[model samples]
Target: MELTVERGDLTTVAADAIVNAANSSLLGGGGVDGAIHAAAGPRLLAACRELRRTTLPDGLPVGDAVATPGFDLPAPWVIHTVGPNRHAGETDPGLLASCFARSLDVAADLRARTVAFPAVSAGVYGWAADDVARAAVAAVRSWDDENPAALDEVRFVLFNDVLLEAFDAALVAA
Candidate 1:
């Protein structure tokens, strides 16, 4: 898969699927979560609630992922993953990494050719953006090795310039 760092609106991406960094509840919150909720409209929220009601295993908490319609975004689907909030320390780091892994796993299952992801848990969750950038790239690389052509294009979609730079640097280093 091809990986690139870019600063753009996630709602505008033309990928097959977009990964949303969401809270555990999957109910709307600030940062990227809020942006996605607003752009996807009410239907996305209802869809999330319905999915939550049945799909997820009980007491699983965050660090898991679920897929649903993109609602108002250009993409056909949205894969929502609940990232660690950084309070759980190194264990949280692995949980954060799982968010990326799980999202790509879903993309592979869905036969998605393109997927866009925001820096998971970097903003409101408070993980250093640069560090999370490296973790994200690593997770994608690991998943890509197993899935092969699951995704021809994977974008690290950053909303801000600083995040873009950090992701770019991490990807280049990788």
Candidate 2:
């Protein structure tokens, strides 16, 4: 799979699937989660609510992922994964890495060719940007190695220059 990093709005990226850095609640909180929900319109929230009523009554766990129709967003699907909250003492790097891995797994299961991801856990969740970048790059690379041809492209759609640079450097280092 091809990997690319760019400073852009994840909500506007044209891809088969977009990953939402969602809180466990999935009802839509701040950062990328709120933005995605807003962009996708109220149907996204309804879908999440239905999921909560049916499959995920206790909310999604950190490092696990689930999908919903993208609604009004550009993508066809939205893969929601909760990243570990470092400030809450959930400091395992593996948990952070699992966000990316599980999201990709969900995307592959949907047969999505192109996926766009925000910097999961880097913003508001309190993880260091470089750490997030490294973990994300490594996870995607490892998944691609194991599941070759499952995806055509994986784009890191960062919100700012710092994240874009961090992901670009991580991609180079990987």
Best by TM-score: 2
| Pairs that clash in candidate 1 | none
Model 1 Cα lDDT, one tens digit per residue, 1-174: 898889998988999999988877787788888999899899999988887688752522567787889988899899999888776553466787899999988887888899999988887777898889989999899888977877899998899988998898888898
Clashing pairs in 2: none
Give me the overall lDDT of model 1: 0.85
Clashes of 1: 0
Error of 2 at 142 (Å): 0.4
Name the runs in model 1 displaced over 4 angstroms.
Answer: 57-60, 88-91
Instruction: Give candidate 2's error at residue 34 in angstroms.
Output: 0.6
Best by lDDT: 2
- Which digits, one per residue and each the tens of the lDDT, describe model 2 over residues 54-151? 99999999999999999999999999999999989989999999999999999999999999999999978899999999999999999999999999
